[model samples]
Target: MDGQDEVSAREQHFHSQVRETTICFLLFAVLYVASYFIITRYKRKSDEHEDEDAVVNRISLFLSTFTLAVSAGAVLLLPLSIVSNEVLLSFPQSYYIQWLNGSLIHGLWNLASLFSNLCLFVLMPFAFFFLESEGFAGLKKILEDLDEQMYMITLEEEALQRRLNGLSPSVECDLLDLEQELQNVKTLKAKLERRRKASAWERNLVYPAVMVLLLFETAMSVLLVACNVLCLLVDETAMPQGSRGPGIGHASLSAFGFVGAALEIILIFYLMVSSVVGFYSLRFFGDFIPKKDDTTMTKIIGNCVSILVLSSALPVMSRTLGITRFDLLGDFGRFNWLGNFYIVLSYNLLFAIVTTLCLVRKFTSAVREELLKALGLRKLRLSSAPREPDSAKPSANGHQKAL
Candidate 1:
């Protein structure tokens, strides 16, 4: 009788899971079509001179923004599904499985949270920094250069004037050259100043949401780190074992969801690497807003490497913290690392080694410059459009509505 009861329960569970999956698929399809229709309605014509690059950038932008618009909402809503960190980044199986897992909300939340973290912490700040300091050094540096030139020019002019006799031909020529150069520098400086004033609004456009999401991500990271530490310190006898089976939430992801998740990771990796390089070369922050369309393939290639590197990582870290349920991964979530070695490798050793190397290379001028050169080449491909176009306004408006 007990055997029959268990079998019956399993059947019921699977049935519900499939039903929920069906509904989710329908919902996704509806949303996808609606988004496409809306975007097409607002789509504007491109420039005559606009190359393949603009087409690619526009496509990439729309696809990514549409997905992230979904995720931004998910980060706000689906976090309510979280019950405990006892599971470490996931809710317990069987407890909230029907809602969070059957429909894949928990996984979405996890994925969304990661992306939200990157946007709030890295990209948002970097965007502000980019506007403040692009094209011809910066306002302060330009001012200093302009002042130095004027001072030198004045000194030369006065020295020539002080000559006991009327100025020599060479002295007069020298003063003329200095004055002309100073006038040129002043003109350039004035134009740069006007540019800064124009972009002042963007610099001040710091969204409050950035800080809120940053706090959330920081807290989550600290929790995971702390949970892993406890796992290390607490004897196995003291800590409770994980409940339910592997992949309680993971399940099999659809192609759409997979693409969305991959995009999430790619965005994170690109921003991280680019921000680091920009800081290194310009000794300041890097551009976060889509720079150029030419770099599409480059980002894809770099992100592929990042995916492989972090592929086995975050999941195993969740394992170390003893996640009682899987969240975002699909079929890939079926495998969980119960052993300690994988945990150390994923959570501890990877960061340690990478940090050490970064630190070493950071102080070494030659290696640091070389790293910048290689990264800069990739950055060069992404040469940003002079400025976002007026026609993009409708798309941006649509995104605002979606968000």
Candidate 2:
């Protein structure tokens, strides 16, 4: 009978774990589906005449805002569930009915808490960073378009110079016409510059949220770090192992959490500062040079490299190649690392590193040019040669005549 009871208890525990895991998975699915529908609506509602690029920017911005709200709210609600679990179990339950009632409430709280943390710390942060990156791409595209336009203007100017030197009777008129066209292009370029500046200013809307989240995360990380330090001090004092508050074992766990949080914070700051400065410099200079599009594929590739390096690749490589292996990874590779609490922290660190590296690479300029050659724009030298005859030069409207 004793053996049978033990077996039954084990079965019950296994079943309970399975149910909770399924519930958490389903909750995540539902949240993701909802976000999908929300983003789809924004895409469909965009105006028909709007530039495709503008519509894309709108969708990306909306997605990021929604992600930020959901992530912050979920993290904030984590404490409530934790409190319910600890406090509800201790309630006096002499009656079977009372015990069942408490158990149901506890279960519900756990489910809610689990869902919130998954959304907040994992899905939402990833989405937020992704959208921020899209914003950078949009700005970059605008700058490229500006460059192409300038190059075209330069080409027209060069052709006009050729006409003026060909001895054509219409050389004087061609010069006048080409100068007018160049002035018009310059005016349009000025308007584009203003638009770029406005877009940069609009990007500032995200700054407040970024700063707030950073501060909150920093506080949590500091608290955890302090806890881990206290634990280490207790261990060093050689007190009774059991009596040491947050014993060495628990302190080690705390230390792991601290490291994860600290890494996450560093990556986030790196992205925010780097992106802000990089984008600002691009806007300030108004340099128009063709650049490769840093599309979604590039971002994914960059993120994979970052995650591999920071999480597994570098650590494993060092261990295998070096003479010594340290406790650098903490408890990250263990089964407990998959626990809800552990995963929530782990995802943040992973996403931060990936997103930061990807954004930095996205903003890095690979090409530089002072003239827009692709758009037929090249620097021209003034020639004092005889003017072109009328039949060999362009018309007053800037259209070249048939030879």
Candidate 3:
């Protein structure tokens, strides 16, 4: 009777846990939907016409930016959901322990798991189907607008400065208004210049090397997600239970899931910092409009597609996937560190090869352009040179005009 009672209690406890997890999932799902709406409703158009002098408006804008950044950072939880009990973060001694101990990630794991599953099973394939929407049009428009406004502002500043200069030294009354105008013009010009710098590919965020790192980081995250998903999707009979370390519960994974999750959360924080510091960084995917015109955005979409291919698991699950289990719905025990390590190594190699190819492609194009420019310049110099008549051609060292 005691044994039966204990089993019944365990089952009840399990149901309770599931109940709470379901509630959290529903709550987060609602918030997730709301977040999109909130981001979309922000005052993007206000950027065009807001008075720079309005302290209140500026404060409101800052708050809005902060919210967007928070959402962007929240996306890091995606890895935690994907890596699950397998990663080091799930290690009891790991620092991420607090996450499951009444932390946000612990409370919201179900939602995150669902999100990660969708990203792996649904979005990855969709990205291949829609690799790109549009690109560079929005960027060109912003650059051209900045250039035009800057030129106008420069002319305005000069005109105002000239007006102030024309006034008599004793005419303090007229100088006051002109001085303020000039100051405002200068301020506006400075703002435009800053925007241009942020948008430039050569600037810090979008630099080629930085881009490669970002791509690799994202690739690793996707790989981890795939690993977790595979544990559920693959045939359970093959590996069987107890073939690895003692299985850990997902709830206990509050600490650290893996190295990748830890890195992702850190990256998310860094992303927030970068966004807040006046770089025209990526929005939290607030809108799709930029996909048509922004090269940076286009690259982001491309990165997703590339990562999906790198993280594919067809070799193991190709035949057994459907026959074995429905993914995102099985018991994938933790403690498979060796398998995880091997998988990580394999992904690293693949990512490295792809990165090298991309870098080489970039280098070759740059070198080709340089060579073309050099050849063109040489041709221009030669074609423009005067050809002396054959009879009057001078020797290399000594030549006088043969009149």
Candidate 4:
């Protein structure tokens, strides 16, 4: 296409991309508002219960609601990105050629766009996982507190029962309200313990799985960035003589295509390895530790490993065997339907693994309380120790009790 025509097309593409981005931003805003509302509603409803467990449940519900909103936002933006790609095609041929010529300006713009798009995908999942992890952590704390509270109430009830039994019939009637309150507290405590167990299981499994996936995603992101840089290098080298500008090169087109293809292959391999590792980690370490704290150092190490492994593989894949796009496509063609089938199968497997981990954790937690009871570790009152029998004498008059 002529220079003028290319410029016109580029303008159109730019406008289209802008429109798509605006739509995406608007959708994100709407989703944020919805998330806030849902969390607020859950909190309000949860606050009505006076028990400690009820409070924890409310927090968990709020976190879950927020996560759902964030996930919805991410899914909504995926379509917007697809639409943006379509819009980019409307640019003029000359404008596109200029942009692809590897000028510093074009390179910077491309990098910015790539990172922005990646963030769009990564943010939602990160938010969902964060909320989930925090909710589970909160549930554990609440349950522990409830357990303590129940123990205290139980002890107080025992002591009060002894006193009531010792009292005259007329005096016992006066203590009925206190007795009823203690009973209600005991019931609430039991319910809380059950809920706590269930929530702990979810937290244990979900948090680790999410962390693994995030690490994989981080690696994928580095590979994507490397691919974009490689594509830019190839474009510069393959430019025709007459079209060559200050920043463009006159390298062999075949060599450029070969390098690009190699990079893509390395990317796919890294993705496969990452998927496997993520699946395995979740399955093996899905149990909750009572004192589990957020491991910032582990996260940092995981991210670094992901980057190094993927990045290191890139040069070896690109330079050693020199596989070109034609070669790669031919390899895939041999498998025919299996290629696409495997792609879908891999995704399904990952999903199944994650789901199973979640279910197992949930099941284990369901029986945790019963198991504890069977082990003679049933809830005990914090203050249940026997009081030293009346070290001070009882009041001479029955109307006054001893200190």
Residue 274 of model 4, lDDT score: 55
lDDT of 4 by residue, 93-181 (tens): 54543323223223323333343334335533454355445555456666876999999999999888988788445557758977999
* lDDT of candidate 2 over 1-403, digit per residue (tens): 9999999999987876676566546655665566445434433232223365555544554444344334332322222222332333444343432323323334543444443345446644565455556665566566776898999999999888886888454778879989999999999999999998887654444443454455454454444334433433454332111122331212222124545433433433343344334443676433322123322422322322222223222222211211111221222223233223334334444544554564445434431122122222334534578777878777889898877
Worst 10 residues of 3 by lDDT: 318-327
- Decoy 4 TM-score against native: 0.25
Clash pairs, model 4 backbone: 6-92, 6-93, 6-94, 9-91, 9-92, 10-91, 10-92, 151-380, 151-381, 151-382
Model 3, 22-93: lDDT tens digits are 756665556546644543354343233323323333343333333333333234333444454454323656
- Cα lDDT tens digits for candidate 1, 68-137: 3433343223122232222323344455444544345544444445554564455434433443343233
Q: Which stretches of candidate 1 lie over 4 Å from their true place?
A: 1-18, 26-195, 198-227, 237-291, 296-313, 318-337, 341-346, 349-403
For every candidate, C-alpha RMSD to the true structure in Å:
24.0, 23.3, 16.0, 24.7
Candidate 1 residue pairs in clash (backbone atoms < 3 Å): 291-384
Worst 10 residues of 2 by lDDT: 317-326
Using Cα atoms with residue i matched to residue i, what is each candidate's TM-score against the true structure?
0.33, 0.27, 0.33, 0.25
Q: Indicate the TM-score of model 3.
A: 0.33
Of 2 and 3, the candidate ahead on TM-score is 3
Q: Cα lDDT of all candidates, in order?
A: 0.44, 0.42, 0.43, 0.42
- Return the lDDT, model 4, position 181: 90
Q: TM-score of predicted model 2?
A: 0.27
